[model samples]
Target: MDLSSELSEFLRTRRARLKPQDVGLPEFGRHRRVPGLRREELAQLAGVSVAYYTRLEQGNGKNVSMEVLDSIARALRLSDTERAHLTHLAKPTVKKRQRAAAARPQKVRPGLAHLLEAMETVPAFVLGRRGDILAWNRMSRALFGDFDSWEPHERNMARMIFLDPNSRDLYPEWECKAVEVVSVLRLYAGMNPDDQELLSLVGELSVRSEEFRSLWAAHTVTDKGHGSKRVRHPLVGEMTLAYESLKVSGDDPDLMLVTYHAEPGSASADALRLLAQWGVDEPAKPADVPE
Candidate 1:
């Protein structure tokens, strides 16, 4: 992916989403060619020269200062994630040498795997940067179905959400879930533009799923954190579960440990207990086991 082009398109899309009135600019009754604030208007708001801002938008501002970037971010009314993405695009840290030094396949630490196993009632899983399910607990299998059944390359959450037919039936709010997956992926893409696997995943999804393509084009970026999702599990039926996403400490900053829980004494909680019991009675297929 061309950083310059990505930066230019990201800025253009963000600029196009805003309106003159949004930034307290009065409508001048002039026929506007662009949908959002004009380059001059944005420049005025950001306290920069129109020429400089234009050059930045055109991907020609090589020596862009942090102060200028901040001003532009403010002018665009960008969110925290969007601002971070802008900074990354303006000055990416990953170089050709860094990209060439391919990362080894991620594995769950024994301690973390043991920790996950101990959480018998909680559905937990560790996800790699590209949403690959690196490791998951027994309850996680009960909640989200058998990850071991999937082909190694097909273990990505984004891929499953878009390509797996079962996912549509599993999540009642499929659209919302799908959007979140795309936004999170977009965030990762901004951070690691040169990741060949990630690029390939995006390429495949963009070609195969119209919905994914549309969301990807929107350039929305989001950080994964605590959230609630209502899912309809085939075995357990419908349940609203709260989930927390934490970064795995140690060498792998890109790996995330996600755990789902329900309110104490709630029906969802009971369902989880039942799911755990089911897992105990009939052991889930191990990750190494093929379908």
Candidate 2:
């Protein structure tokens, strides 16, 4: 990917999402040509010259500083994920002679596996940075369908969302979920341009799925943090459950713990109870279950 172009387009797209009134700038008139904040207005907010901001948007700011990047992020009212993305793009790594490397999928941590195994009531899974399903509890396998049975490197959520028709039907709000996947993938691309596995994943999606291609070009970025989602599982019906994504400290960049829970006595909670019943007779062993 072209870092300069990616940086430039991303900044422009973000800036275009804010208006003068949206950022507390007084509304002048409806004669605005662009969609969001003008270059001069954003420059004033970031404490930079209009010409400099223009150059940056045009992909010519090679000596950009972190201070200025933060200022721009502030001016744009960027989220935490967006701020970190700006920092990553501003400091593109110097090219190395070694070929770009794919992330080597790591084994599930023993302690985490034990924890997931114990949490039989809640569906949970461990994910790596690139959206790989490293491990999942039995309930999670039942919740997300049969992904845990797939090999780690092959069980990417983004790929499934785009390529698998079953997944598209399973997610009630599939479009929203698809955008979130692309946004997170965009962040990963900016932060780790040398991840050949990720690049290949992107390439494969772009070639195979038009939805993926379109969203990828939008250049959005986000973190997979806490959120609630609605899923339309064929067996359990529709459910709205809250989920938390916690990063697992490890040598690998792609590692996090995700757990889901529904409010007690709620319909969703009842559905989860039913889902857990499938494994009631099976061994409560971690290794036996994929998710």
Candidate 3:
């Protein structure tokens, strides 16, 4: 993605989302060509000169200061995720060598993998920065279906949300889930605009799914932390699971360890226990005999 163009579009869209009343400005009986706060109005609110703010909005503010950016972010009422995205776009640190190195496959640490395995009853998985399912436990497989069954390239949550038929049926509120998935990816894209894999994934999804295309164009961003999700597993019927997304520390700061749990003594908890039993009872696939 062209950093300048992305920055410009992001600013424009964010600016267009706010109205005069949103920022406590009076509406005069004058004709306005553009929607939301005018450039001069925004500049005034942000305590910046119109000319400087115009240059920043036009993607010419390569040397934009953080204080000014912060002021603009507050003026536009950007969320934490959106503010971070703005900072990334305004001051990108994409070196060709770093971009090339990031293309390598990310692996879950042995300790994390062991920890996941130890939580036999909890549905847990480690996700890479790009939402790829790097590693998952047996409960995770039982809860979300077997990621091992899919090709490596097809193991992305965003891709599954838009492209997989099973995912649509799995989530009760599929549209909302889809939007959240896209929002998380939007955050990743902003931070690493030069990542070829990320760009390719976005491009492929945009071409394949019209829904994805429209949402991507919206430029909405969000941080994926703790949340509750309802899913209808074929084996367990319907269950609402509360999930937590914890960022892995140390070497893999971008990796997230996600785990799901149901309220104690609830039907969802019973369903999860039953699902675990089913997993234990199910026979393993027979190995193929070599000819």
Error of 2 at 272 (Å): 0.7
Better of 1 and 3 by TM-score: 1
lDDT by residue (tens digit), candidate 1, 137-212: 8888888978878889999999999999899998999999998999899888877888889889999999999999
Candidate 1 backbone collisions, by pair: none
> Which tens-of-lDDT digit does each residue in 101-168 have in candidate 2?
34443677677898888898888888775787777777887888776466655688897899888887
| Reference-based lDDT, residue 110, model 3 | 71
Q: Residue-wise lDDT of candidate 3 within 1-291, one digit each (tens)?
A: 787888888899999989898999998867778988899999999999999999998888678999999999999999888999999899987778667657877777677777887787888988887898888888888888778788888888998899998898899999999999998998888778878889999999999999999998888889889989999999889999999999999865678999999999999999999988876854332111122
Evaluated against the true structure, the overall lDDT of model 1 is 0.86
Q: Return the lDDT, model 3, position 155.
A: 83
Candidates in order have lDDT scores of 0.86, 0.82, 0.86
Write the candidate numbers in order of decreasing TM-score.
1, 3, 2
lDDT of 1 at 266: 94
Best-fitting candidate, measured by TM-score?
1
